[model samples]
Target: MYQYDAIDHQLVAERVAQFRDQTERFLNKELSEQEFLPLRLQNGLYVQRYAPMLRVAIPYGMLSSNQLRTLADISRRYDRGYGHFSTRQNLQFNWPKLEDVPDILAELAEVEMHAIQTSGNCIRNTTTDQYSGVIADEIVDPRPYCELIRQWSTFHPEYAFLPRKFKIAVNANENADRAATQVHDIGLHIKKNAAGEIGFKVIVGGGLGRTPMVGVTISDFIPRADLLTYLEAIVRVYNQHGRRDNKYKARIKILVKALGIDEFRLRVEEEWKHIKNNESTVPAAEFDRLQSFFTEPEYQTLTDNPSNLTEKLADSTGFSRWFERNTFPHKKAGYRIVTLTLKKAGQAPGDATAEQMEKAADLADKYSFNELRVSHEQNLVLADVQQDQLVDLWNDCKEAGFATPTLGLLTDMICCPGGDFCALANAKSIPIAEQIQAEFDNLDYLYDIGELDLNISGCMNACGHHHVGNIGILGVDKKGEEFYQVSIGGASGHDASIGKILGPSFAQEEISRVIRKLVDVYVSQRTAEEHFIDTYRRIGITQFKEAVYAKAN
Candidate 1:
């Protein structure tokens, strides 16, 4: 993790003081609700259904042991004894008092963390692969670029208030895109040209909310040095021309759609010509300065498959299953990246209790080089766990209720805090997620079905990223009653696609059965070794829709 320098420290301290004053003014009636809206939002404070929700940024989803402990302490003292890890790789405290948020900010500042750029209509947190530097399949570490963007975009004077919130994702891995770059406002796919020079394959206009669109490749190749300048050009074009009349039509995706990719590319190119050679073009010194922070940790030299690990896997089926599902290949021979699932049965997805957070911090310190990562799927990662220590770590995780061994299964769902907490939501999402999890509790059945991404959103805001799920579920309200809408064939990766709706919505109670029918259809239609999404794409959603509705009819 990058430790804050003196400038970083001072900047965050000043911002905290400023927000404290702003909050005090609002509470004292010196500032009205409308007047304080932007101020509070800029500080990552949202007025939810019942109370204020404070979103704290985990830059590129990286965290240190100290930072994790600080978050756990914040959860224990300020809000309810838990915090929700969001789909954007941020953490949200759902019940923080409005007056207490400044103090919370101050606490976060002590640990080199903040809420800045986590909310409001500005450049949000820049996320990347959770296994950025450690994964074997990466082309280059994306964290330095993500960090550069974070620093560049933070309180940027020109882009403080864009037409709408903008998101950016960077992917260095050629095989998989865990960051789901294709669905972000700006997706940077790091690649090497024919001459072997590094550059980005820039994709623009992708988003998920009301109007879902996969990004179009605006530039086939932009040199690494020109990344920031090119990005500035794109945002400047959007800021100058994007719609301000309607909130729904303000996102960069809408502007890209209206202008067409060709015209949009032309405008950006024109803007880039003015600044491409300027300070915005990252200098070699700056690249070295940022890259120095993300250099590989000191790792011990050991074999890829240690005798102890092999023996343990051979002896215990439980250990083998957990290893197969929860762990990922690492670049280092002796190490593995482990995902500690937050999706326990009966618990809301991504909601980690204070105790669990503290436990995770301890575990990270003890076994994983004192570091952790927040995955886009709303799970935590120990990116440098030793292969030989897997059993002990698994035992500790099992004790803490995180050893689910259902990483890509149906039970490991991505969900949002819907109507229960969010004012924007039309229907409750947690109860629905819980019901589905309960219905799919059988591990044997889930394993037989293979990998499935089931995402649920409260409404069309797509906070759960329901648009990209293999089996997407959206909660809808029908005459004050909550109904669930189902979609199929959506995916998020190198080949991302928005899910297609499968006819009418179902009642909350009927949703699990609907999902079961959809799964049954997949099981019956799928060829050997085919995943749910593959089968859905192969056979199409028509049969699944028919099966689901036939039961209802």
Candidate 2:
């Protein structure tokens, strides 16, 4: 984790003070609701259905155990004792009082955290692979670059008020893209060319909202040294030309769609030529400085396949199932990356109680070098857990309700806090998610289905990233009645694709049954050893649609 210097501390403290004043003015009636809207939004405060929601940034989803403890403390003291980990990898406190937000920001500042850029139409959090430094297939650790972008975009005067929110994701692994880079406003695929020079394959215009788009490749490669300048050019072009007349049409994706990829690329290239060698061009020394913060953690050398681990797996079916679903191979032989699932039956996806947060912090401190990561999939990662301590960790996780063996399964959904919390939501998402979880509660059945992603969003804002789920559920309001729309074949990663709508929307009660029928179709049609997505692509959406709708009819 990058430690904040005096300057960083001062910046956050000063911002906190400013927001405190702004919040006081609003409460005192010196500022009206409309007047305070942007001010509060800039500080990541949203006036939701029942109370204010405060979104605290967990930059690139990295957190020290100490920081995690602070977050837990804040959640307990200020809000309702739980926080929702969002798809952006930020934490949202749904019940925070408007007056208490400044105090919350001040507390966050002490831990080198803040609510800045978590919301509003500015450049939001820059996310990357959750398994960044620890993954074996990675060509480079993308965190340093993510940090570089974080620093560059933080209150950048040029991009502070874009037409709409901007997101950027970086993926360095050739084999897997846990970061979902293709669905970001700016996606960077890091690679080394045949000449062994590092750079990025840049993609632009991708986003999932009212209009879903997979980013188009603007540049096959941009030298690593010139990354910042190149990014600046892209944002600059969008900031200048992106529509402002209609809020619905203001995003960079809309601009890209209108101008076309070639024209967009030409504009960015022309702008880049002027700024290519400017101060924004990151020097080798700067890269080295950032890289130092994310160097490999200390680990004892051990065999890749530990004998005890194999023995334990063979001994306990419970342990074996959890291990298979929750753990991933680390770059280091002795260490494993463990995902702590926040999705449990009957609970909202990604809602971690204050106690659960504290426990996770304690576990991270005890076993994983006191570091943790938040995944875009709404899970937590202990990225450096030793294989030798797997049993103890699993037991601890099970006690804390974080050891769900449903990663990539139907029940482990990515869901937004829909009509329950978000005023923009047309319908409730948590209920639908819970219903689906109940419908597919059997572990054996889920494992048989294999690697299914079900995502739900209350509206077209797509906060749940429903557009990229294997089964995407979007809440729709038709003639004042809530309905759920289903889509299939969506996927995120190296081969990203937006799902196609199955047919007409279904009533809330019909959603779970529709999902069950979709699963039944997959199970019936799939070939041997095929994943849900692979089978869906092979058979197309027609059969699944027919199965779901025909049953309803």
Q: What's the TM-score of each model vs. the native? A: 0.99, 0.99
Pairs clashing within candidate 2: none
Error of 1 at 371 (Å): 0.4
Per residue, candidate 1 scores C-alpha lDDT tens digits across 1-553 of 7879999999999999999999999999999999999999999999999999999999999999899999999999999999999988999999999999999999999999999978899999999999999987888899999999999999898888899999999999899999999999999999999999889999999999899899999998999999999999999999999999999999999999999999999999999999989988898799889999998888999788889899999999889989999999998998999999999998899999999999999999999889999999999999999999998999999999889999989989999999999999989999998899889888889999999999999999999999999999998889998998889989999989999999989898998998999999999998999999999888887898889878433
Q: How close is candidate 1 to the true structure, as a TM-score?
A: 0.99
Q: What lDDT does the true structure give each of the candidates?
A: 0.93, 0.92
Candidate 2 lDDT over 27-146, as tens digits, reads: 999999999998889899998999999999998999999998999999899988999999888999999888899999998999899999888999999999899899888999999999
Q: Which residue ranges in model 1 land beyond 4 Å of their true spot? A: 551-553
Question: Cα deviation in Å at residue 176, candidate 2?
Answer: 0.8
